[model samples]
Target: MVTVQEQGDTVVFTVEGWHKLWAMRSELRIPRTHILGARRDPEASKAWGIRAPGTHIPGLLKAGTFYFDNTGDNKPTFLDVQHRENTVVIDLADEEYNRLIIEVADPDEVVALFGPAAAT
Candidate 1:
């Protein structure tokens, strides 16, 4: 699981517990301008294509960096989701990770933070 918090003009995503090792990251900070939007998209966590440096256990957990395709330009995605129901997808631009799919306690609350235009 991951925790989201807003600090000034940046949004912070802190990886919790063992997810840190799987995701190979302790935290990610993105400028507010880089955030495209966010949405509740549990299904997005399904069928993750290829994991370069991450962990995936079929119906269990998915944490780390993943690529949807082999194409070189395919930006990677960071995920830390165990239960699909609690997943929220955050889209970004001009960042290392193209997207973030994580399990949060309250998906609705998180989505609301990005506003209605954030649904993607």
Candidate 2:
């Protein structure tokens, strides 16, 4: 399952896959995917200095930095570093990234699937 926690100024989201692979360990190995970032307000995007070519998977996995502005006017602009990247650049602000995170079984699962040191 995916768990979200807020500690001070940082938000922690984790995906777990313990139960997801219980039945199909042979057919499916852990899946590696990108986690996207998003916000409800346009101003938030601007506040965070988020432009085009948004945050990617590799960067997120390596550095843990994600694009997040604010959903309100004069939102706090900052780069959230939650993970790092490897190969591809998956914009976290895009809908596709949200979809992937939603479909994942757990937040820890996502880390297991895409963490920078997973392959190594």
Candidate 3:
């Protein structure tokens, strides 16, 4: 399970999962980075057009929460994205799963990163 907590200006993400553990054991480091102009599920609510935290996909802004299949088994992974006061929250539940958190200055940056036709 992923848990997100806020401490002053920083956002904390707590991730826990078997796959995450195995991956970290193999690599000794978690892969984290910002992704830009990535695709989103059509069925997703809120349209998630803003750049949010992600891995591999560059230019993607780290906004709200996101979830993906980390085990390559086609099963859904758990994630949480929330906003508290001036802070944004991201939480993952799986130690082996890769997670990224992006901190941007304002909404304009989010739009610039994840807006349609934005570069990857």
Candidate 4:
């Protein structure tokens, strides 16, 4: 699981446990302005076409970077989700990752951080 913490103008995502190895990094900091919105999307990583530099264990785990080949845009995604049911898709702009599909202990709290206008 991951923990979301808002610090000033940035939002941090802390990857916990062995997920740190799977994701290749322990923390990610994105400027609050770069966060377009967020939503609870269990199937957010369902169509991830390739695991470029990440790890996946079928229905068990999907951590690291993935690309959406079907979209042509090849939208890059960073995923650290163990359970689909507790995933949140956070859309971003002008950032390294186009989106983040991660599992948080309380999805509601994370979504609320972006506010109603930012929740799609």
lDDT of 2 by residue, 17-46 (tens): 432232111111121232333212211111
Model 4 scores a TM of: 0.91
Candidate 4, residue 103: CA error in Å?
Answer: 0.1
lDDT, residue 49, candidate 2: 38
Candidate 1 residue-wise lDDT, 37-87, digit = tens: 788888888855788888999989999999887325689988999989999
Cα lDDT tens digits for candidate 3, 9-67:
43344443432332222112322222123222212222232222322222221232344
| Order of the predicted models by lDDT, top scorer first | 1, 4, 3, 2
- TM-scores for all candidates: the values are 0.91, 0.21, 0.23, 0.91
lDDT of 1: 0.86
Candidate topping lDDT: 1
Q: Cα RMSD to native, each candidate?
A: 2.1, 15.8, 12.8, 2.0
Query: Any runs in candidate 3 off by more than 4 Å, and if so which?
Result: 25-119
For candidate 3, give the lDDT.
0.29
Lowest-sum lDDT 10-residue window in model 4? 111-120
TM-score of 1: 0.91
Deviation from truth (RMSD, Å), model 2: 15.8
Model 1 pairs whose backbones collide: none
